[model samples]
Target: MTRHHPRPRPLAALLALGLVVAATALVWARAGAGPDRCVERAERAEQRSELVTGTGPEVLVIGDSYSVGAGVQPDQSWPVRLPGRVRVDGFSGSGFSAGASGCGDLSYATRAPRSLRTTTRLVVVEGGLNDTDQPVADLEGGARRLLRLLDGRRVLVVGPPATPDRTWGEVARVDATLQRLAGEYGASYLSMLDADLTYQDDDLHPDPAGHREFGDIVAAQVEAMLTSS
Candidate 1:
């Protein structure tokens, strides 16, 4: 009878298995370390938190078509449906750049109150969609100017909603610039593009259901911020 010996496991195979295990453990550790980064990323990616609130403290929503009703009813808009006592100053067609032609500017400059006086504590800005046609630097400068106009009021900077067009890369650039501005100014930066409200009848404006969903997102963020503040 010949002696038989069990074969040793292949070193390369063992190494590969080890690497996989190590990678999996590393991922698990990272995920367990803090607030679900994945969930946060998903939420931020959706860009649904454009409308900021200050219900208990006082709140204001100011922007263009995205802020306004667009295809949705005025009451269904985030600024309108947000919980608690809130005020809306949204204009349907405004842009950040001065004299920028569109519904945002006309509504913002002509209709919306220049200075909120009703014990206003928080302000949400939702413009810049129209500004995509302009240069990024111009858009940034316009945003800065808008922030300056707000004075001492606590503000939240909301970037424009995303469109289905692949060529409209300017939206990302504008959103990034606004987010940087928000950080510089110590304000909240919410991305309408990340909110996942991209599906619209015209591929530009959100429908009524979209508005309601967006409003809920904004309301949650506002409520949390106000409660903490």
Candidate 2:
């Protein structure tokens, strides 16, 4: 008597397995491709040290890469360009809920404690673009949490500008969310959604010229708020 051969696996089953493997591999690659968390944390810690040791800046600007000067020089960044002593606590690839590999969880709220200082006359919260993909509830929750932390302080919530990489709808939603939160928290809101801005090759971050323009716009807003107050 001959032994029965093992039954062949179905082609559809094999194809499904391959797709799953491919998708999993992609996720892993993306996860590993993010900036080193340790380095990011160290840099953030350095920023805190500077703020703590040196003369506290008049304006404390907290944001993502735009505040960090992603593709430009330190002085070229808009935060430094703002008309007064400004200290930036910008983390690239970070947002209210967008925490990269090594950055702290729920980035903005987690670091607000160390970033704000007694000398900071104005707290300019400048971001939301990174959280474009976040659910409205999550985005609102994150903004509320950060705003609560800044309660009783002078705050200017600067929402994200429109970018080529992001849909107008997506950017507008973020802008709207931040604006609502700012109003509820007694903070002034500045929306950059309509600004005609330029960006780097990536179409995400602003170029040198764009930084200058952004700085000018923010400076004007800051001045107006401070003057009125």
Candidate 3:
């Protein structure tokens, strides 16, 4: 008896080929889109953050996701709700040299040059959690670059809030270094570590109510800074 080999199953072959092609296309799409999307989103966030569209002139606040209000509405973001016309230059996933994404080299040093004008009033910078792993030298350098850019403008440097992702020890180091930099530059330093606040599910950012409280504290700090200056 001659047994003929079963003919190649056209349906099975087609389904296998289809799956392979689909998977390949998906990988290609992700590979092409990932970095470009990162940069594009970052740029758009920056553009949105810089509008001088408030009541009058503006106070500037610059930082990462927190400053941009990641988990909340643009209007509800603390910077917009802040007591004055506020110009902001915050972007998510940004830091001096470290962050949760894109490895974060988007430091204030890089931003303030392009974002700040000589006429800007006071600037508040809220970052540190993103700089948790940064070298003291790098952190200081970033802060100094920003302070120099501000020159005669009043500035405040805000420390990050508590996050379970980092040990308090790691967070403290960054805060201490920033505190030193603030003193050196005469920019005020406000530690959220000292605030009575609540956080969102992510624990990395604050909720709407938290932002309101945060805006109040920042307003108070700015008022004091303005009065003292």
Candidate 4:
């Protein structure tokens, strides 16, 4: 008869079992094995920010502090990376208006006419952080109004970027709401709500690199709009 095999070591067996469990969990998570995994993966994608893609028209950019290069140098702003002739009329602490309270009743739409020169081929509505304090209804209405004013122009509504302090839900709401409004008004929407995007130490404004990233993203979108139109 063959000699009896040495009994498996209890500690070794437990350790092996633990490793198998951990490996299985990792694989399951990556494969989106269940509802929790699916949600987790979706969340990861939603929160990521990296390079973005196009060339196009003489574009006009209107936004808030993010538009104005809050913490970063002026050259790092998103508007600086546009294709063709660009006009940047970004307000540091202003947003669209649904009433007298929003941006002193002079919103991007109201201020846009004055900022235009030659022929504005595209209107990039950049930031809405100033509208965060405003009621949601007002924000939506203001966006609607501003988009309406850009009527025939190729308008790109770039949703407000997400900050570390703001929960995912808050940022998602702002982004989804604005995107919906953009769709309603026949404008294209580009979300800047990725959590992985760079930000300043304050965690509010984009760092120089972040702005550059945003610029690249908008440039790509601009190219698409121009080519398609």
For model 3, the run of ten residues with the poorest summed lDDT: 96-105
The local distance difference test score of each candidate is 0.64, 0.77, 0.73, 0.69
Q: Which model scores highest in TM-score?
A: 2
Cα error of candidate 1 at position 1, Å: 99
Instruction: Score every model by TM-score.
Output: 0.67, 0.78, 0.76, 0.69
Q: Write the per-residue lDDT of candidate 2 for residues 23-76, one digit (tens) a residue.
A: 756643543333355475457536533542123337888887888777787677
Stretches of model 1 off by over 4 angstroms after superposition: 1-55, 103-113, 165-168
Model 4 per-residue lDDT tens digits across residues 3-57: 9988878998899999978876764553325446445433432222111212345
Candidate 3 lDDT over 1-229, as tens digits, reads: 9999977879988899999778756643633334566676577676667555465445788888778777787777778666567888887766654223352356777777777776677788888886776677777777777777777778888887667666888888888888887898887889877666667887768888888888888878887776665
Cα RMSD (Å) per model? 20.0, 7.4, 9.5, 19.5
Stretches off by above 4 angstroms in model 2 are 1-57, 98-106
- Can you rank all candidates by TM-score, best first? 2, 3, 4, 1
TM-score computed on alpha carbons, candidate 2: 0.78
What is candidate 2's local distance difference test score? 0.77
Candidate 1 lDDT by residue in tens digits, 87-197: 665544356765344212342334335547658777777777767767677677777766766757777777776777424587887788889988887788888776776
User: Which of the two candidates, 1 or 2, achieves a greater TM-score against the reference?
Assistant: 2
